[model samples]
Target: MCRLFAITSKDPLSPMVAIEALDVMREGHDGSGVGLFLRDLGGPFDDMKDAPILSGIFTEKGIRRLDGFMMEIGFMTKYKLSIKIPKTPPPGVPKRDIYLIRAYEYPEEWEDLTSDEKYSRLMNMRLELRKMGEEKKDMIVFSFWPDVIMIKEIGDPLSVARHLGLDRKDLMARVVMAQGRQNTNYAINLYACHPFFLEGFSTMTNGENTAFIPIKEYLISRDFHGYTGYQSDSEIFTHILHYTLTKLGLDIQTYKHIITPLQDKSIEAHPNGNFLKHLKHSCRRLIIDGPNCVIGSLPDHSLFMVQDRKKLRPGVVGGRPGMFAFSSEVCGLDAVIPDRDKSKDFQPMHLDTAIVGPDRQEVSICRQTEPLPLLR
Candidate 1:
């Protein structure tokens, strides 16, 4: 199993804090890779919250190509920051040519476009760059958004952090999700690392997705451009969230019903049982069939954690007045917020969703409810 760790705080905090906690759960993962995603960014990004920032690794040739393409598309670089790789990386970890996080000014024409239009444009640009990178094998773009940055590397979580110089205080965010990956079914591909992102939704998981094939097929069938990659089964979880909330116009809570709907007998007992039954029958392809613990964040900065119906994986949610964290084990949380009230720590059972809202002021536990019809 892989290990997942996420924290949402009232103030921007360095991801190194979560990485350190992940190191404590080292035994759970084989250290194949470490993936990091940060939102509600701080440091240089705090002031540029409205500018779209692109995060990726590029070779020298790839950098030139990326710049030329961006210029052709009317995007000009406003600011750029690169991770400072350690002078001497650990043995066996390949050296990166360039790790870039750049903010870009939109095309003048884009000023008149609606927010959704601008968002679609950015997604198109990222997808084009990603395809170009796939052809050249020189660039690896992880994310393109205003207040998010993603980084993934092949190595132990702690070593990857040190190599990327993530200990610096400036690399911070109000939300951070980190995964110590243990590849089970696929080759050791960097893109297969956890904390997959699509639009503004991001997710990482700690267990397998036995129903990945159908889920992948279902998502790819959608007209959306971002649903093409299935590097890891866990990526489906992110797409599922995006589909359930953004595509289907359902509440985030509805995701639990869609992904792991209650049994027919149980569903019939709820007020919305008939509606849920229809949803389960119509979207049965989206149901996840393996034991998994998922941690995710929405565009609004709300953080959530859910476990599979069987509760095959371990997850603990804990927080105080200004922060919340979800981890595969209590040891991970203990490393970060040791002083918090242990008595209040929660272990979400089957069919439970723990959500920490954007305010970071409270943790709401939304349990499984009877599927109710959509109130018109």
Candidate 2:
């Protein structure tokens, strides 16, 4: 069972909506309500021989191509409301912290592509990073932003566990020890991609007609047998998440959005059958600056194969300005900046600084004279 979990305040304005939406995508389901209507792609679709071309590709063909792209790949079942909050949150609570779970179903034959293609993409993505470093001297472009780069010194691993009433894990205990070695800060960025509604598949046709299996029972089925590599890296982390959530008495549901084949007249019910098109405009662009690591982990996991700045480029920069950056000098002499204005008449002195920028916008920055200790 593919799943994503998160905690958020009950406040409607809480970033939880957006975070849950992104998680639903990562779990690979259109989910219920608006999501359910969008993920279904089972009905017959209208041909696009005469449909006016929009964007770089024809709308109809674009949808068909997308369906072809992920035909048999098993993604997560629709989003599940594992835990529900009270209608009226507790007083003094600014917002409700919610935990979400999203599941994925991938075909066995296509598993290699998920892993291999991802590795290739990561290796090639270095070219784009190199170009950015050479051209955009003011910023950093990292694969794992909010997770590894824009980490929250206070509310992340250590703090979160404390809040959750769980004993401090050894991994986090070490991070705290490392934090004592230097200053740490946090920043947030939200990726605007739909996982449930893939361009490679049609959800309109599949709307409401889809089938989803419960993640718990699925975990014990044949599909879970003979799986490898999940033990390494964050895979087990997700498994642990499943156990944690289940122990908390969360509820799970299954639903599929099946697109009707184009041959049937019923397919016309879903006129466009281009779920991604709905997503194109519906996709909201967001930049958060708090404990939003749950969502950030999505890109980190998806593009896990991407190399780091030191490896991708000798002097490459990445992440938010202060969250992560590159320097010309080995120690990044430029990062250490003196109060240039403080000097009455002497030459300018550069300070040690790392600039983090997102979508052409500079957000937070990290600067310090002391060196950051290396973590094993």
Candidate 3:
């Protein structure tokens, strides 16, 4: 029952997105979920008297919302911990505001420890953490991403390892290797603009077989190649905007200018001659602020830095902006085709956000992948 968590200042100095993500975590897992304990600390809301700040902020009732969602997704709740605290003094160093308290729930066979045994181990682990000088700190507990997948088949790691044809030690090694590959892949997605992992393959050979299967090659292709137009639907653009704004601390109002030109060009190039005519004139200009809306073409290759760690740099090598797998120049078998009928095509996917690494690399943020796949 080992868990991982993150703790950071709730101030703008610390990414607001990270704090928002805490809300998501609070609303995404159940009390028994393995990773719930990792979300044990939070705070420094804009309003000191925020509801979450006062009442059952991280209460079992509140966390249940997230837990229910997880169960809906075929994962069961196994462990969790949530704590809410008041804002600390600015000068007084805020101890670890975020504490990722993980409980390693080994299989029942690991030694059916009563509450006392569990408490003892917890105290021991805490002592060890203290020895390592991690009292109230945000630390990356372990490099290994626990394989909850094992729970799907067996009760414990030992059985899972044996089932996978590896000893416990070997299994741990494999897990680390796999996690490393996943971490690198994530870095690549962040570097590339395609941050969201939404692309899938649709097979319509038979009308009955119109289903989607996650396509890895498509992701690789997009990473190597990139997006086409200034399509708002693409998640890549959002990530680019997020990373850019976060790192540069530029005003969003000014961002509209940067994007205006691209929008204008996209409108000009639309297949339909009339911009608003195709809609049967039903669409109204809800609020048109001419010229103020577009962002011109951003070069395919560009340089940028992380928000908190500006010195940490990365380069966006290439990517398509608005289009999907439909308009790819690289068709199957290296054959160049003019166009493919979309009546039988799978929808192009977009990643939610791309996380650029310290090096100039990028990777998509799909549910973390198995590290083993990237070893090749």
**In order, what lDDT does every prediction score?**
0.88, 0.21, 0.21
For candidate 3, the lDDT comes to 0.21
Question: Candidate 1 has which clashing residue pairs, if any?
Answer: 272-371, 272-372
Candidate 1: C-alpha lDDT = 0.88
> Each prediction's Cα RMSD?
1.5, 25.4, 23.1
Tens-place lDDT per residue, model 2, 151-185, is: 11122222222332222121110000011001111
Instruction: Estimate the TM-score of every prediction.
Output: 0.97, 0.19, 0.18
Candidate that scores best on TM-score: 1
lDDT of 1 by residue, 135-187 (tens): 99989999998999999888788987888888776688999999997456889
Off by over 4 Å in 2: 1-58, 72-104, 110-368
Worst 10 residues of 1 by lDDT: 367-376
Candidate 1 lands at a TM-score of: 0.97
**Number of the predicted model whose lDDT against the real structure is largest:** 1
When 2 and 3 are scored with lDDT, the better candidate is: 3
Error of 2 at 306 (Å): 22
Model 1 shows how many backbone clashes?
2
lDDT, residue 184, candidate 3: 15
Q: Order the candidates by TM-score, highest first — what do you get?
A: 1, 2, 3
RMSD of 3: 23.1
